[model samples]
Target: MTKRHQLALATALVAALALGASGCSDTKKGSAGGGAGGVNPAAANDGLTIGGTPAKGGTLTVLSNQDFAHLDPARNWVMPTMDFGTRLLYRTLVTFKAEPGKGGSELVPDLATDLGTPSNGGRTWTFTLKEGLKYEDGTAIKAADIKYNVERSFAPDLTGGPDYAAQYLAGTEGYKGPLQGKHLDSVKTPDDRTIVFELKRPVAEFSATTTLPTFAPVPQAQEKGPLYDARPFSSGPYKIESYDRDKKLVLVRNEHWDPKTDSVRKAYPDKFVVVMGLKGGQIDDRIIAGEGADASTVEWANMRPESAPKVLPKPEIKKRLLAESQGCTTMLNLNNSRAPFNDPKVREAMQYAVDKEAVVTAGGGPALTEVATSYLPPALAGGKQSDPLKIAPAGDPAKAKELLKAAGKEGLKVTFSVSTGDKGRAEAIQQGLARAGVEVVIDTVDPGAYYDVIGDLSTTPDMSLSGWCPDYPSGSTWLPFVFDGRTIKPKGNQGNNSQFRDDATMKRIDEINAMADAKEANQAWRDLDVAIMAKSPSVPLFLERKPLLVGPNIAGAFGHPVWVGQIDYATVGLKDPAKSQG
Candidate 1:
């Protein structure tokens, strides 16, 4: 959900369709190989593979430019961090399948016995824990642990995670989190094995939301509050052995993790060593070179666009490339509650002022970006929706000017807050707005502090570069998380950054949630998107196709559609253990 970087519609739509497919099958032809360059996708695997039955022992190295923002599940909201934590450090009630292609997005049981059973007209959900579920230290995982973690997420101190629990859970209107010695009656554990959620509204697709890290179990006894971000108690295949903040994090296999209880993770590698605070260019060069130790490395960050030219021409390195649809849409979030934007006409004008082609070029050209038309990318968009604003890909400056003139804000000046790394994109936006007779003052923030700065409502500027990918591939995940008025907070996690708190829109969200037919609900969500964009809450920028590079000796490498198009950590292993830093 972070503004990182983005797509073809038909191809990307096919990839998104894979995630919506249910049951024990991965039959769809997804977006893994559909890039502009001749970087073919890897062969499909049955939700699990390491080029065959993967070897059991080796150390897999993960090279990254920066450290994880938050390891605490409650504070985890970004894509790459969730990808790592959900796959390695924690276990949720249900997780998407780890297979390549369509199967990789299917919902599968992890700690829970199965996808939860819903009753009370879908207002109540019940999940039974799989027998023998244990934490890294071999303590039993009880249903109460799940309820406790859910309650902890509501803590005022723990912010930035998904707000689904607070939005839906009944009797939690003003409930402070469990840290205050008060427990949530809405999340009930009738027995050690059974857990029930009493929701205020009927939500048919609630199980998919459980895949989020917020739903991961955290035993209250070991909970360290804010300090837990340093190292969360592990319930998955690996536990933290040592973590030195921005330097490095070494993980060893948790012997207590029962593979039988986990249907998703392969856990092929005995250890994982994450090398952080390295330069992106250095990480890219090392993996492409595939030297000693580097031979068994994979990247936590995507390969830089600058490296594509150096590596693409070589047939040897091209095969190691993983380019796929991330199922994400990058956009500019205009603060709706603030002046200039508070006027709907001014917000509408900003949408027409964006030259997507220029923005796409700054975002690394056609291969990496598709000029977006809706907040829901074409993949989950069902079908092509109308461009109500009559948007031109190159931008309709005249239309923007007309709207600005009508609003009496024709030479509108606004501050654009963007990450230092994304200066090019901000400049392109500045130019595009200038053509529409709007002057933009560029405010560059450090890349590391960008989200935290903009996420705070008091410090947020007039406009900021923002993006969203679904928690899962449903409109339910898309619309509610980004546009729901209730998600807006004063200090942390301004999920609805636009701050468009229309009572009608919020009512429609509840209406769509109540629909039992997935197809009907999906179409309704699409229609609602058209209605919302008409208000111009934010500008739709582009859909993304991510390019990931891996070392030659790295096995089971695939661009996980559900994991922000990064290499799947759980299934990855070392082809030659001797070549690894074992």
Candidate 2:
């Protein structure tokens, strides 16, 4: 079985076992609207404004988790937090529109006016740059800069660039050569405004690559040293004024930025501040005391009605909450390459023992029923409320016992590995699995050691709890990384740490990948879910919902799965005129 298949099975099992819990109302409230009290339609408008007016010039103070680990986008593959930092310092050729739709938000031109079609049989792509664009230091952004960024992303030493680049751009004549230390064949800069890309094979999702930060243009002059890390010099609406590492991040308006030309309207606050390291309860207390920070990202459980008084004024503060469908799915990854889990029946039996709903309820919040049916979440696959993938697993101890007996592994002793960070959820999982007659031991480890040990297939654990945050909103990402045969650690090893591999399932995955349209892709993803359900590799846990708290003074603060940490610093503004003047 491929790593993808194992991940899929693990996801399914976690979902099945975690099926016995519930919580708050799951209503279809649209993307978070802006306002002081109640949804403000105008505040959510794309044409940005500060304190209801287009005001530029002011330092926005932001509190983040930590200083970005890497300044270079190519070497960084984490989500919006890291992406947010890079975006301030760089700009992508194309970016998803800041709206909701079938494509979530279709790819629209960012640095480029429009993405050109391939000149030769969909093998070559041409990009025409917008006129008068400049780097932060006043140097013109040119085709050469874009070319350099692309080539650098695929450089031999940079292992952090999205692995998909190697698969998609590898065929581009010059691009393939660079992969093996040979000169690139497909990348070329014809003029200052024009750049072209040649691929070895026709890929329908090629445009998607342009949305990645690695494809964002970088000035050749600033390529050397730790310049990118110092502060942002990109053409974005806001520039990084200062970065104080753990304390704060300050963003100032770019006077050179033209609001009309730029899709985002500049609503620079006098100061936007992010207060980091505060617990959810502490945030509530501070808000109640009228000492709460300007903006913050809080876990969903922390945003209960009880905590509202602390965060919001009794009569005036309005809460606008937006729940984005995350590409992430929490699950228990079993080391199939090891004992106990090496028996397929033992792994399958555990699936029958888990109660997912209970876990969701314990997490505190709404009863999110769209549990993990596959490695990919339902939202990405365009799943409806009535979708079969939403079905919960029937917890049957008898069936689990029978499955264990069938595999001649009646009494299996296994240690369940989970990180200390997930104390509440992991303990619940350990307790739930014990009902299946398995001697499940709970092994807790630090966050760093947890990830390091799990990734090492040679040192596989019996069962481990893991979660996946998608690189993008795509099933291809979830499937291949977790289950693809090629991703396995050792040769001929299917990377199915659960030691569960199925030839038939791998064939189905190929079919899913071949589908061209969204509808086809959605159906293929559902079918893949069903296949994974039958073969349990790991158990799916609950889908996570992150809740955020914003001060009443802050406006235009919205949430997105892509924008995790920062709350759109460029647009968010303080309502108080006094605070606006800071």
| Residues 1-582, model 1: lDDT tens digits | 342332222232223222222121322222222222332222222122333345678888899888988889887877767888999999999888886656677788888889899999888899998999999999999888888888888988887776778877999988879897899888889998899999887887788889888889999998888888888999999999999999999999999999888877889888999999988778889988989888888887766645665565455776677766677777788988879999999998888888876776566544455567778865466433345566667889999899999999987889999877677778888999899998999998876677778878888899987777777767887888789888887776635767778888999998999876666887898889899999889998876666677888888877777777777777888777777868
* Model 2 CA RMSD to the hidden true structure, in angstroms: 7.1
CA lDDT, every prediction? 0.77, 0.52
C-alpha displacement of 385 in model 1, angstroms?
7.5
lDDT of 2 by residue, 133-183 (tens): 876666788887777667666665554555555666645433432334354
TM-scores of the candidates in the order shown: 0.83, 0.78
Error of 2 at 72 (Å): 3.0
State in Å the error of residue 318, model 2.
Answer: 7.8
Backbone clash tally (model 1)? 6
Question: Which of the numbered candidates is closest to the native, going by highest TM-score?
Answer: 1
Q: Against the hidden true structure, what lDDT does model 1 obtain?
A: 0.77
Runs in model 2 lying further than 4 Å from the true structure: 1-59, 100-104, 115-123, 155-161, 171-183, 225-227, 264-267, 270-325, 365-370, 383-394, 490-523, 564-566
Which run of 10 residues does model 2 get worst, by summed lDDT? 27-36
